[model samples]
Target: MRINQPQLIDSTLREGEQTPSVAFTDQDKHKIIQGLCRIGVDEIELGIASPLNTYLPNLVKEAKKITAGSCRLSLWCRCKAEDIAFAATCFPDLLALSIPVSDPHIQERLGKDRDWISKTLTASLQQAWAAGIPAVSVGMEDASRADTDFLVATAKIAQQHGATRIRLADTVGICSPARMTRLVQTMKEAVSLPVAVHCHNDFGMATANSIAALEAGADSLDATVLGLGERAGNCRLEEVIGYLALVLGEQRYHPEFLPELCQLVAESAGRDIAENHPLVGSAIFTCESGLHQHGLTVNPDMYEPYAPERVGGTRRLRFGEKTGARAIQLQLHKAGLRLDEMQIKDLVHRIRSGGQVLNQEQLLRFAAKCC
Candidate 1:
């Protein structure tokens, strides 16, 4: 499925931290919220609220204080009276309650019947409404694996109980892109509320599944920066933003600050940037192979789908076993120096021959020495 266009994009603050190993400190949270605002995200999920867990109230207090008016803040909760009431104290712009629609979670996780699940969700949603928070939504936890009739039945109940949206969580990350499309469309047709899709990356189809959900009538997505989340992760925020802007021709998000937002997330999550991760990965804009280097010299378009500048990156010439003289010359040119053919060849030969690894500072020092 293909997106017709993008409406709005949320950032990786709240859901991004859902990655088991990725936890953000209060300072990190402040930085991430500011960065998301800079990148023009319409919303940010702060965190989940549960008496079943501690720490959400203070996080909400800090998040609300940091973000600008342009970014709406949200919180997630379980579909229970206490959970809903616990979260409403924070006074978030939106409250999303996760309800188990499948027999497994309904029976196993909650130890309750389907009829009981419906009552729980409706009661929780009404509680949020009474608190003067205008927005309420329900997440169909493990919806992708659930029986269709049950999922739709749950969404209709949510809509009837003052929920303006329903989220389908591929909670276990087992959903395929096609299955995502079918399931999202099925629930979307069942209710008048907005539809949101949350996908995990277990099968490496999170982004594809998100786009497919949008194609099948989902109006919103749950994505994370650096694709940080439980297990493998959730839908990657930067990848989805790029695809929407470059491929789908939607400019709903601002691109000028993408790298800043990425950097903020990387620091907050305490994860080093992986070379091969899409979009925000350090190597995403770096060229190494001779052919790629040569083609990039002729036209960056030959090697890159979108200009690196759009994501706050400049083209990088990675000095390695595969680099050529053209790449060396380009790097030198950026340093306000020029190396003729023989000089360029020498640098490439040494780099390719495994003489030394070149970081930006090392290359700059070498260029200064030559001058």
Candidate 2:
């Protein structure tokens, strides 16, 4: 299952910060950057270079010092001179200039035509290059919605203007995996530079689309911790890296750090992680169903796709109304307790009648009192 190691461009700060009411302080930024570096991500987009805030420069400096060149830092900007100029002052390893490619976004948002977009993008890239930025990544906003020919042409123009990479942004997350694969493949065939993908989660397919892009020939992928972004969110950092490891057999990232990183990002964003969040969720590794518990007891792999430890998690069997006698026995044995058949049967009956899930402490107390 070995495959090419696609570079991970974690956009937690740039995109995740865009989540409603989410803001990261200097300390929060540093912690996130440090964790991303420790996990060996290829790059991190710090934030947009506009607004010229007093804290942004200091944040970029602190991030640089923290990373110490272990991971690359990139800055996002609009297709405007001022944005690029200000981003250049941050001294990021790469500057990502965004341009609207779709007709709707172009005509509605910018009130410009396709020709205008191309010219503006060309000028922006030239400006960024003239500023002597280390590198430039062109962000094709609404790329998935744009016409394929126009998208490819835009990428070509960007390359002509010295863009080091072309980021295909699924701005609305309306792309399916099949569409993603086709678009990425077409872009790869048309462009010479690396093609990266930034997917949103409006359709709950950002992760699938990103992986599809990778399989189609993309060089890098963008993600945010917990998929925190505008609307539904973006591709989840933990989910993408974990999928690469457990399914695709790529192991460059340190999955063990995801739990801590997830907590850090969630705390910074002031958001609660759902119990069903794929990688760092509290209930992802918790088993409750009788069939699942039985399979897990026999062999974890029989029921679980991968071990919980693979993503810095632990497995726990929940005793609930669905608890079978064998599952209760397994739980009791795991808790280092022994019970006769009658006691076990009685306990199963009580659990089934309780009509709710019981935690380890409650189960332990029950077992001790009954058996």
TM-score of each: 0.84, 0.93
Tens digits of per-residue lDDT, candidate 2, 1-371, equal: 24487999999998999899998988898899999997879999999898665566777788889999888888889987877788877788898888889999999987889999988988887788888898999999999899888998999998887889999999999999999999889988998999999999999999999998998889999999999999999999999888887777776778888889999999888889999888889889997888899889889989888889988888987888987889878878988898989999999998889887887778889889886
Q: Cα deviation of 20 in candidate 1 (Å)?
A: 3.4
Mark the 10 consecutive residues where model 1 has the least summed lDDT.
4-13
RMSD per model, one decimal:
4.0, 2.1
Angstrom error of the Cα, residue 191, model 1: value is 1.8
Give per-residue lDDT, candidate 1, residue 117. Answer: 85
- Each prediction's whole-model lDDT (CA): 0.77, 0.88
User: Can you write out model 1's per-residue Cα lDDT over 25-51, one digit (the tens) per residue?
Assistant: 777877877877766666788777778
Give the C-alpha miss distance for residue 178 in model 2, angstroms: 0.4
